[model samples]
Target: MNAILTVLEIVAPVFLVGGVGFAWVKAGFEYRIQFVTRLAMTLAVPCLIFTALMKTEADLATLGTLAVAGSLGYFVIGLAAWVILRLAGLDMRTYLAPFIFGNTGNLGIPLCFFAFGQVGLEAAVVMLAVSAIWSFTIGIWMVAGKGSGGKILKEPMIAATLLGALFLWQGWETPRFLTNTLDLIGQMAIPLMLITLGVAVARLTPGRITTALWLSVVKLAICTAVGWAVGTAFGLTGAIFGVLVLELATPVAVTAYLLAEKYEADSNAVAGYVMVSTLTCVIGLPLILGFLL
Candidate 1:
């Protein structure tokens, strides 16, 4: 009744906006994905993270605890993903990274914000920061078999996280005018990211459909189980705990496919992962939201 309507309110916008991009591509409309992605990641998302952190009412200690638990969730899931890959006799390089990381940025952040309001978003951003740091460093290394950890420092996501933390720690506020400007920019991030997600999926040519399908299921299960375990163990509750499970259980990131293409691993397989995992979210996210609510 009321719960069903509540879930719909939270989930509908994400799908509809993403669906618009999906429909747009199907109708042969132009969407320069690279440019849009660059804008969102470089400018818009950073602003969102900065403002979210700077303005958050959550206790700093709780946020820090959530951050640690989120990292452990990733570590535990990475180990589980590795074991699954080995048992399935899959390629380590092509599959490992995607298994560990999910679309915490594009999908998780918006979903959390919708589900739990400002507090949910505050917790969600912390998880996003943790995911970005790992994906930029070890996740990249997993694909390329080389270290580019330094690149993590240069990422705007990281810069915003650090700066916002500084502001939060010092209990400082930017002038109202600048704060409003940043908030305006931040507002663009979630919708832009949702649309970009759809565009990326529409554009992908996924191979290994069967493999991707089962693997997506595995990914969802492992992340959910591990996230639950970590959150409970850390004594996280309410918005923070819910965000932990949801973010970790998000679909495989589109960036994983891009990284495979760049590193010459197996782009088509990774693309399959991205598409199938995202599709699962159509059902999986709702159920998770139902349970959490």
Candidate 2:
């Protein structure tokens, strides 16, 4: 029962902040989702990643292990999802990326912070960096029929991760004033992302929602299992293990719908995945957290 309450404490703020965005959109507020997302991703999120990496006292070896475990988890999930989709006769372009890449950034980061504090955030950031690198490169290729290797070079988060990793390795710190300013900027990332997520979901037009529902269930099970198994194999315990599973099991990203739309795939269908999977997680994530706790 204490575990249940702890799960609630961790997840309540996440959902509440997201609910605020949903309500804002429903109330006919001007959200400017694209602008907020851009700010969060290009500026706020990068700063957050940089600062988190720079300041975290997590052992370098542990961070490295989490990074490796995260990469393996994604690879296994991709292979498994590919097989499932092909057998189910679904459109690979539309379904594969969503299955392979969960919302490790917008949702995963804050949830980890709430659940496990700074240590969780440190581990979660590593997972996010792994997911982002792959999503921008390999995940894009699956959707667009061409790899976006260029995007890897262009993304600020990628740069931040590399620079942060360098600092972590070298035990360097930015000037105090600069660190404080960046920290302030980074503080906007979580709330901005949560609110933007609500705005984006509110704006989506779902298609084949029933199909999406089943797919969401299956995806959740697969991801939870795979993340658990991989973390166990790596001998990960406590917060790191929980984080690996939680980050891998986040709902389908709103960005997947946007990507489908941008690439002229089945945008409405992808919207269903985004909508139902996210909504399903309202219950699903908590249960997972309950178990982890």
Candidate 3:
């Protein structure tokens, strides 16, 4: 059907770019992951967020609604995940954050753009901003038993989100040259993130594959259901509803593994979750998009 081909057109480039990175690593090439991540987070992603927000012509009310919906959806998911983890006797420090947060940045953003074009990106960006804020703050605290509220304020993405919102509210535009430069920088974000995702997965040392597989299945089911429920309850329609569900249903983030390693909490187990969940999404997302589109 035409719909199936459309979904393929949208998903093929995402996985293909990731495959390139996977092949690069397997071919004995060196990739400085930390450096690439720093570049994306500190510079490229922020620019991307800022420009997207500034240029987006989506209704302000719609953006506001999506923002609140996103925040509520994450909070509800976190609570549910916490309950499940506790009842299942899982380590909170190791599993809680991974269960709550998904890969809204790397995979979700580009998928939105491809599936629904500019409006989808706009809605997805709002969700991403909400996720970024919570992930840096509450998500970090869950992993490290320490609050990162101050650190969230220092994040470039946070600043860009605020500034971009301000620009959107005020109907302001950057100078043409500056906008073009930022746009160029922002354009690097998607490809770099997709490639980095593949590279990171390639390098991960996964353990407990059986456990990871089951947990990932649980995560997918819970997240997809919650996202659909929340978006429907909020009365989100068209691209907004689709973007919200897609972003929320993304796999466990690679950052979750990095955070576990940094906090000395079963990094290999977290890596297993990351790998299993991401591989699951390779099939899952396109199916979701097929229905959404």
Please state the error at residue 217 of candidate 2 in Å: 0.4
- lDDT for model 2 comes to 0.93
lDDT of 2 by residue, 141-255 (tens): 9999999888788889889999999999999999999999999999999999888888888888999998899999999999999999999999999999999999999999998
CA error at residue 282 for candidate 1, angstroms: 0.6
Candidate 2 — which pairs collide? none
Off by over 4 Å in 1: none
- lDDT of model 2 at position 156: 92
After the best TM-score superposition of candidate 2, give how far the Cα of residue 124 lies from its true spot, in angstroms: 1.2
In model 2, what lDDT does residue 271 have? 96
lDDT of 3 by residue, 184-292 (tens): 9999999999999999999999998888898888888888889899999999999999998999999999999999999899999999999999998888888888878
lDDT of the candidates, in the order given = 0.93, 0.93, 0.92
After superposing candidate 2, which stretches have Cα over 4 Å from the reference?
A: none
TM-score of each: 0.99, 0.98, 0.98
The alpha-carbon RMSD values of the candidates against the true structure, listed in the order shown, are 0.7, 0.9, 0.9
Model 3: residues >4 Å from true position, as ranges? none
Better of 1 and 3 by TM-score: 1
Ranking by TM-score: 1, 2, 3
